[model samples]
Target chain A: MVSKTEETQLNRLENQVDNGGGGAWEYLCLVRKLKVRRSEKVLKHGLSILNDPKKRSALGPEEWTLYEQVAIAAMDCQCLDVAKDCIKVLQKKFPESKRVGRLEGMLLEAKGSWAEAEKAYSSLLEDNPLDQVIQKRRVAMAKAQGNISGAIECLNKYLEIFMADHDAWRELAEIYVSLQMYKQAAFCYEELILSQPTVPLYHLAYADVLYTLGGLENLQTAKKYYASTIDLTGGKNTRALLGICLCTSAIAQLSKGRNKEDKESPELQSLAATALEKDYKQRASDKLGLLTSALRSLKI
Target chain B: MGLGFIIGVFGVLILSHAAYSTIQYRGLLKIMEEEFSGPPMNVVLELLLGFVFCIWAALTVPGKFLSIHPDSEENRIVSLSANLDFMIFNHRAKAFPLEIDMKLKH
Candidate 1:
């Protein structure tokens, strides 16, 4: 999801910090903003600033946020000691802070103390039942501890309160997909598509689920969604093109000779195939044979 | 990144330098007891060169303008409001108890 400019800026900042160019804080903030998984880089560069007292103070009030950032990145990196020390600094500075208490719960989670983490999250939830972050954390904890059903239940309950959360819906849809529950996954994808009709990812995912469900009506609907995905992505997504091909061929086979004019629109398959060929020709002409062979196997 | 960004900044610096040169020229004219005319020719040329550099850099920075377009699908607001604070990377779904699947199926 990161833009090219932002990605290049992140690389430049990382190099600048690595060479002691003194922008460790800026690099860490960009990393956070992008939500990138650069735990090692963040931990290394962040500790350099944290270990230096002068550099830490130079950030002023932002230093506390930097400490929290480093703490989370450290936890991701499995550096419990550094995370503990950072949390201790935060706790000492802001005693009775619910934010710091959340950090404590996350730390317990990182240490694999499931019961303690649950207890901590429960207490936090007790203080504020509408603590959405804490509730999500509880679900994530359940998922992390291999309690898939519990995670699903918790996510359902969480969605009851936060129905507008597309991310949670996506997470639930993904969990259902992994469990081979295409119907449930399709429900979640429908919810997501209803909320965000412009998002091609949701459309593509819904099409995938619908195609996997596999029936006359579902395959037709899946092909429609796949075409919508292609329109949304400007015909750049090979997966959606392939989906259109697959759905077309499947629908054709299922409805073979059933009617004189079944409205199958045989031209749709050739159009999809042409688009696929054009894409392959422009990008990887060397592997065009593989693509043609694969398409031939699909009978489209 | 360094090339385009540096060229842009250099153009900005040059434009500022041109402004400064104009001011210096005015001061020199006042000291010489002459009329306060326009900037020197070299400063005008420098301004044009800087403007061209800025335009070039603007058109070809780290990426193309379509990526930043408001209507492009790639620029869509997909996960801007994602509640990632609760995100956990270490998923153990594969290790989930098989009995639970049997229970869920029914």
Candidate 2:
């Protein structure tokens, strides 16, 4: 049913494949199209060309491009196993290339080789120590494997490499907080605040850790850090919240003093009074209610 | 006599500043205790000043007492203006939240 000209075009394409100049990807594409079109002759020709061992051996840069092409074609054809095998071959051939490793890692991840992907990412990180993408990918891979500790450890390692990376610090802090590792989280938050003295939430985070640690001395530091947050905010709306936190933390620290039955110093009482008066209206209703309860219990 | 007087004046000024810090710290402590219900102002003030005084004394004490020669490296690191590059290296291991708190907007 096909025209002579169409048949000749097919023959020429097959002959092109036979010459081994077009690379693996080119042949894969032709074969895939022929399979879709149900052209048996073209498909047979493509398969024959691709399976040639001599063609595989001659793969240089052009061949690597061909390998990627063939792998992608295999993926497109839903032959994921074939694609993976092709990538493995490429990995062996180009062991030193980051691109090859990354591609292999992606393929492994696609195939659900979570642990292998993590190892590949780890190896990549050794070469590109501050590669944020790899760092994130490594965390994701660890977490996917249900290795929460592993995920945390990987990020901690990343933090060591890129210590000033606030995002890494923040991520570590969040993870610690989630695990109820308050002391460690607080230390991380402190580093964050010291690194970026302007961020108010880092102060809040530090204060949260102090509260969780449950001590008067920690409470005092929390109050001071909150004040620093407020001062840094310079009358921003957030400053009002920070100021309230500062007051509340101060109040908590003050309550600890009552354990000694020491009469409240007048100046200390005045400052608390002033803070209470200033922040009362602005304080969140829930927080204010909690504050009232604390005040009653402490008899402040 | 003139040189001695100048030296005496310098010493007095340093002592006066230290005394002022002490008094201020004590006042803050009293405020903290009465207002927040905490420790004596003097104790709080003393604790706060302890580190400051140590650092101050360490830096200002003449070469005779545990002398540390001033180094350019320390000076370069603590420039008056905020140096972004230096800050990056100094705080490399520390991560601060990039989410700027809306409440902190100046």
Kindly report which residue stretches of model 1 are placed more than 4 angstroms away from their true locations once superposed.
Answer: A1-26, A53-55, B1-83, B89-106
Give the alpha carbon lDDT tens digit for every residue of B3-82 in model 2: 44455455556556656766676688778874435445665565455545555555455434431322122211111111
Which stretches of candidate 2 lie above 4 Å from their native place? A1-116, A119-132, A235-299, B1-106
- The TM-score values for the models, in the order shown, are 0.72, 0.39
* Fraction of true A-B contacts recovered by candidate 1: 0.11
Identify the candidate with maximal DockQ: 1
CAPRI category for model 1:
incorrect
**Candidate 1 chain B lDDT trough over 10 residues, lowest sum:** B97-106
Question: Top TM-score: which candidate number?
Answer: 1
* Listed models, DockQ each: 0.06, 0.01
Cα lDDT tens digits for candidate 1, B1-106: 7799899999999999999999989988989999965777899999999999998888788586555443364464333333465567463422331121111000
Clashing pairs in 1: none
